[model samples]
Target: MKSGIFCLSLDTELMWGRPDLPIWRQRAATVRPNIQKLLKLFTKYNFPATWAIVGQLFLPGDPLWHGPDIIKAIRKTPRQEIGCHTFNHLDFGRCPIQEADEDLKKWLQATQKQEIKPGSFAFPFNHVGHLKLLAKHGFKAYRGPAGHWFAPLGKAGEIIDSLAQITPPAGKPKQANHGLFNFSESQFYVSAWGLRKYIPLSSRVGKAKKGIRRAIAEKRLFHLWFHPINLSDQTGPLLAGLEEIIKFAKQQPGLEINNMEEMTRQLN
Candidate 1:
């Protein structure tokens, strides 16, 4: 077992980041601060992070959508890589496999302008139908559940996640099932909000850090992920808490935090 790759999906939506389930307006303003804070800290630490930039967030001629400063921020950030989440953040699980292929291909075309063809993908809602389509569509990896997601088949690129989220509002908004996706081994999924919820997941950052540290020490890869917007919002502990996490990650010996492309290169 080794320290796994940390993959971040920077999506602009009302799905998970804004746990309040904020509508469109709030969703836009919410993620800004978290992303800003994340960028500053990542740059300071010289951590190369991968941003699964939501293609819809960069729509041409749309001021609200294109955050040039954010793009610049990512470019200025060291060791950062970019990937796609789809043009409109379309739901692949809802569409035919081939239809989803076309949608994802369109995303590839848009992202190709920046020389990114998405070696990996974080499905819009992690609602997967047919994963084989990913390998068919030129995606070398699919950042999804290791196995239980499909039952009977789970492999690489199908990363594992264990969210373990606590302190809920009222209902389990489809995204709130933070428990591990019923998988054994090192395969588990965690989300952006998990960054904050880790307070509930572990006794203290040190204990949690030890687990993450141990995974790395054992040479087992442990991926910690979340959306940039999830970190950007003005909501909770994101802004201030980010520095602490980065500083902690840097202090751990043998633990190297890398962007997605680097992770794929190292693992795949």
Candidate 2:
């Protein structure tokens, strides 16, 4: 690698991102504001962020829900990279392979109507499976779950994950898995809500900075990911923490920041 790479991606699925959780639907009010804040940050930094959206979010809505606006903003943003998160946010690891394949195909066809040929895919809930299906569908890369102790535990993993925002252990980068590029997450931005809210902002920043520093010195890929909803409750603190990390990154020698798709292209 020419320099350490920092990859940032957002699972921008809205209600579909967490269909089972009522909190996702209840927190609907904060979506737009959170998006706007992130957009401003992107503009300020010329940052490229991968938005792995649930395919349903592209459908026309009745104004009460976000659909058209989501599509418009994503399509219009020059620095945003769009990726498929699945049509219904189906869990590929739990659902039948055939069912997941069909969902992927439908998502591909639907998004193509909007002229978005996604080069990347992120499994809904980070439940990775059907890589052959992804490769056949023409996805060049996919984001795996953040590497942590609970990451591989399936359903129980989700609960334990909220308790831990640990960064992945440092190692050599494996550019691809099965057939698609593996741009797995290294750190998850813990939400400033529920139990996680207890984690001091300094601690979150410290962990993220450690990841970035390790990436620069070790010359490895450091990936960070989170949902916009995670910022709904404490947008200011979370964004400020993110800004601190970004500022730290700017000072690092030869470090490059890239969206998931951009990182995949660079690897190839």
Candidate 3:
């Protein structure tokens, strides 16, 4: 049961310059349109997705709060799963553990009104400092960069051929790229995407096509993840490429598109 998961990260840009950030914070200008675009693409292609909503969106006093609207947006797409990025997209490895836990608590609280109970968590910057805390807190799974889902590999893009090549960081489990459960294709950690301006549509489609083809033949998982903000200024071509890839995906029988949470459950 291989799955092609599209996770649209909804990180609100509440940058350091709080005073100047609001100019970019116009919900109608930023979050709303990108999200709407995602819904349209997902619906147009009949793909299921996971939305990792920022937790601060539910903060009561913030005037630009999009908690209600974000939820409404997710409802527009079928098989959309809700997950948490953080109260803000603060890197958890540098953030105080207490603060991180508080954000998770606040995120859970924000979801009390919704039908979804998020079982998966994605770290901002793909940094993790406390898996014990997350597990102790009842989080079912933590999805870090496949770059080193089996951590201590000298950041992503570093070459460590297989699990045997690198020593596990003290106690972290060794990863198996060429293994029985998953294939090396899904094991690739994204080095960077959205690199060039109006990049050719074939470039992106090729990645999806390659992943999908390999998944069909090898029975592997084609996991593609990206931030919505990556498309902030140059979303036109990205969306078009995504629409094409997704449309192509739905046409393939047994080519399922599901959320990370669903994949986690099935894999585990």
Candidate 4:
């Protein structure tokens, strides 16, 4: 039987994650520490993860936004893959091809200075586009959009799924154009902030457990992703919930935890 894969990907964008939302700026201080806590948790579990960081976070300048120190910390962490989240967090689906190309070029230049050559990419806002450019820049894989039928329904569908405690869909990786492997996400791992706070932690953990079971039974990949800032407000409880899910996944036989880069190499 094929080994079931439990893949964790974090969109490690601090202020760059939602520049349009002024509230995220106010919560900036919490992001770095939350990420640090997450790293510790990953260490404790002996699990690897893919951290898709925004390009601007690598450059030196703003203390609130830029975080070369945090970048270094992630690099030093064992089995953690640092993937690109694009420069300026461009919405590739909406942005013009020329603009997307420029953004990717800047991302390559910035990551190069940090001595980081990322083989995996995560589209900003999960808005996928510009595959040829990604291949041109030597990216081997990217986290694609959610494959569920309700994905087109947006946040409403997400809320309903969370409320219903539905088992998220998992699938095998598919080769996209330009030889890039597309790892479709299973779930977003609902944040404990905003209106999402009403979503019981049990629901989140339970859903993840179910997804893991599905993956193991079907020999598919369960790719769970979330932004670090999502845990800023309810840090302890959220982290604990995540730990529960991780522990559950770790206990399962034949379930292999993998970072995005590792998955790409395996699929290749």
Model 2, C-alpha of 264: deviation from truth (Å): 1.6
* Highest-TM-score candidate: 4
Residue 31, model 4: lDDT of 85
Clashes of each: 26, 0, 0, 0
Backbone clashes in model 3, listed as residue pairs: none
lDDT of 4 by residue, 234-262 (tens): 88999999999999998999898999899
Quote model 1's TM-score.
Answer: 0.68
Least accurate 10 contiguous residues by lDDT in model 2: 158-167
| Greater-TM-score candidate between 2 and 4 | 4
Of the pair 1 and 4, which is ahead by lDDT?
4
* Candidate 1, 138-240: lDDT as tens digits: 6654445433442443332122222332111111111112211211122222223423354332332333354455555555444445555544333345444
- Per-model RMSD to reference: 8.9, 2.9, 7.3, 1.4
lDDT of each model, Cα atoms only?
0.50, 0.77, 0.55, 0.87
Model 2 shows how many backbone clashes?
0
Error of 2 at 223 (Å): 0.6
| Shift in Å, residue 256, candidate 2 | 0.5
Residue pairs with backbone overlap in model 2: none
**Order by TM-score, highest first:** 4, 2, 3, 1
Residue 30 lDDT, candidate 2, scale 0-100: 80
